[model samples]
Target: MKIAFPYMGTSHIAFKMLIRDLGHEPMVPPKLSKKTLTYGTQHSPEFACLPFKILLGSYLEAIEQGAELIITSGGSGPCRAGYYGVLHQKILQDLGYDTKIIVMESPYRNPFDFLGKIKSVISCSGVSWWTFIKVFYKAWEKLKLLDETEFLSHQIRPFECLRGETTKVFKECLNVIDESQTTEQIREARKLTQELLNNISQDHTRKVLKIGIIGEIYVVLEPFANHDLEVTLGEMGVLTHRSIYLSDWTRESTGYESKKNIIKAASPYINELFGGHGIYSVGHTVLYSQKGFDGVVQLAPFTCIPEIVAKTILAKVSNDFAIPVLTVFLDEQTGKAGLQTRLEAFVDLLGQKRAIQEGVVT
Candidate 1:
């Protein structure tokens, strides 16, 4: 089958590899752009969050390009993300598209069912179960490497002496990673990726702002949806650490359940899972503040309930921890210029606060 999936940052690199290795063609949609957002917004419910609209737009385009099956992740929560598949299926049917959609839910919810689903998909390839296991392991390893490389880029981008050099090297490294097929190739790519990043000339004497990024996973990961907020922050001399990564989420959802500490950290504010990553966001914010980050930026869709909840609690977190927090809600209509202005002002605020604490200002 010709399978397709929506884009989320560099995740497509791994997903494409996984699908192709499974003996299916991966029909990735075009990169997200204004036109894509417009198509999604036109077909999507007006109140749907930006991710939903963007994904719908991607699906439409992929279907138009002859995608036979669409694969998407699903959730069970008060968050609207849980219902996106059903709603999307209905919408596509209404629009006269009969594409098959496979929604992968949390394996922890039903391990047997999850394995059964995986077996059915693997059966399509006529490949042995051991082969499927090896392929999936390789894909997962690649995802971890990709996430590590990206995290390193965020740390290095702010300190690079030559403007845009870090970005240029990062892109080249990603291409190297994408082409890596074997375990040894991936390890070599990792070494080269580290070497390339370490070679970027950096101003060690320059003081940089440390910022933690938290919020809805889609907006946090998808650069287009967030107006390239991570790269923009890096370019402005701010080092950013995102709270969530695809590999981490995948590991936890696949029954590892290693986030108890994060959940415990959120106890003082939001003890229970309020659907989505509300508790995790709060926990990560608290953790960032303790780590002495200068500020935190929370990105969310306009009507994202979990983020809204986190935003409200974050105000208290900011006051109690003496850390600055900025919440930016995104949508199809969000403009880059406005976001840029807000970020500049926020960074300035952090700088002034730091100077005051050091007695540089009275």
Candidate 2:
């Protein structure tokens, strides 16, 4: 059976690997684009979050490409992600698409339920337990490789002797990693990519502003959703760091405890998990402040409830910590030029503030 799933950053690199290895053809939706956004928004409820609408658009596109079974991640919380599978199925049916949707309970809610869902799905497709285990490990390894390459890219981007070279090499690495079909191929590609990234000359003497990004998972991880904000900042000579990542979330969702839980760290500031990334967004801001980051940028979709609440609490954190926090909203009509202008201004402000602290510009 052919399977399709919504694209969530580099997670798809590993996710697609899993499906293909299990002898199922994985039909990945096209990357998020203006056309995709338009298609999604046209058939979606006006009040839905950006990720939901994007998911719908992706499903529509994938179904058109011959995906018969849809596998979507589900959550259990005040966050609408929990209900996305049902809503998506209903919408597709209303549109006359007859594909079947399987809602895999998010691993964060009940690990057993998640495993059961996985077992059920694969069992129907006739995959053996040994095959499933091997495929799962291979997919996970891909995810770890992808995240490490990304982290390396972020670290080297700002200090590269040549602008855009780091990004160029990083893209090649991602493309190689995503296109690898065998575990051996993935390992070899990863090693080569690591060597390439390491060879990308960087100027250690150059000064660059360091900014932390903390926000909704989708917007933070998906470059397209966030207007390539991290890349934009890196090109402007600011080192950008994100607190939430796909690999860690993948581990947490799969029943393994994530190494870092900003939610726990943020309890002093926010006691309850308001669902979604709200808790982490608050915690990451405080963590960023503690790490001496010059500024923190929180990216959220318009009308996102959890982030809206986090935005409120973050204000207090900003004042208490004296760290500047910039919250940017993503939507179908977001313009890149305006985002660049605001980012430029924020970087300048951070630069001046850092200079003042160092008595360099005073």
Candidate 3:
């Protein structure tokens, strides 16, 4: 099938690889733009989260580009993301588009659910269910590894100050991996990219404020949605770390139950305070705090319930643990200037907090 997938930050890179590996022509929608967001917001229900609206724009664009199938994921939760694919399908249909919508639902609930969907999308004659499972697992491993590496590179990018060299290398690495290349080749590419990044002149003497960004995946990873906050923060001499990369979500899918059990065993207080997915965010926040990060920044798209819950718990965690926290809520109207101003103020506050902690301020 000539399939298309919407851009959801870095995950789109991995999705492109998965689509190629499955022998489908994957059309990636152009990067998020004003027109894209406007189109999405106009078509989607007002109450839908920002990521859904932005993604809808992507699908609308892709369908116009001769795509026969629209590929998206399914979630199961109180979160609206679970229903996004269905909602987008209905919306597109109402708009007179007749593209096939392929939603890869979570198999954790019913393996048959996913298998049936895949069968409907791709007609494979007499292919055993086990064969499909093996292929899916292998694709998932590649996706998770690529996602984790990209996330790590993002965390390291802002501190490098290499005038976009880090960003360039990161983009090149994605393109290299998407070419159906060997795993060993991809590893070598990553090593060369890292070496190039390390060769850049970075100031180690500067006392940069360390900040952690935690929130919904799309908003945290999409440069357009967040107005390139990481770059802006880096330029302001603030070292930033983010939670909610693709690998993190993939791990949650594979071992969420066990991980949750362990977290509950280790930190019952956290589990009780932040129920459901928020517990994972809380656990990560606590880990970041213990690592001596100067502050924490909680980011969320407007009306994201999971992140809202996580934000509240993180506020308490920050207060109790003596870490400064800044919560930024993003919506269609979120302005770049406003975001930069808030980030600057947050960085300044962190610097003051650090100075006081180190007795640099008397």
lDDT against true structure, model 2: 0.87
* TM-score of candidate 1 relative to the true fold: 0.98
What does candidate 2's lDDT look like per residue over 140-166, in tens digits? 889989998898899889998999999
Best by lDDT: 1
lDDT tens per residue, model 3, 1-362:
67898776666766665566566777888777888888899998989888888889888888878898887877766677877888888998899989978787667878888778877654533445565566566566557656755665655665675666666766766666565344565566566655655665665766778778777777887877777777777667777787666666666775553455436532734545333255666676777778899887777888888888878777778777788778888999756888878888888888888888899997
lDDT value, residue 170 of candidate 2 = 91
Q: What's the lDDT for all of these models? A: 0.91, 0.87, 0.72
Tens-place lDDT per residue, model 1, 186-291, is 8999999999999999997888999999999999999999998999999999999999999999999886659988888888887778888888889998899889
- lDDT, candidate 3, equals 0.72
Per-residue error (Å), model 3, residue 210:
1.7
**Clashing residue pair totals per candidate (backbone < 3 A):** 0, 0, 0
Better of 2 and 3 by lDDT: 2
Q: Considering lDDT, where higher is better, how would the candidates rank from best to worst?
A: 1, 2, 3
Worst 10 residues of 2 by lDDT: 254-263
RMSD of each: 1.1, 1.6, 2.9
List the candidates ranked by TM-score, beginning with the highest: 1, 2, 3
Count clashing residue pairs in model 1.
0
TM-score of 2: 0.95
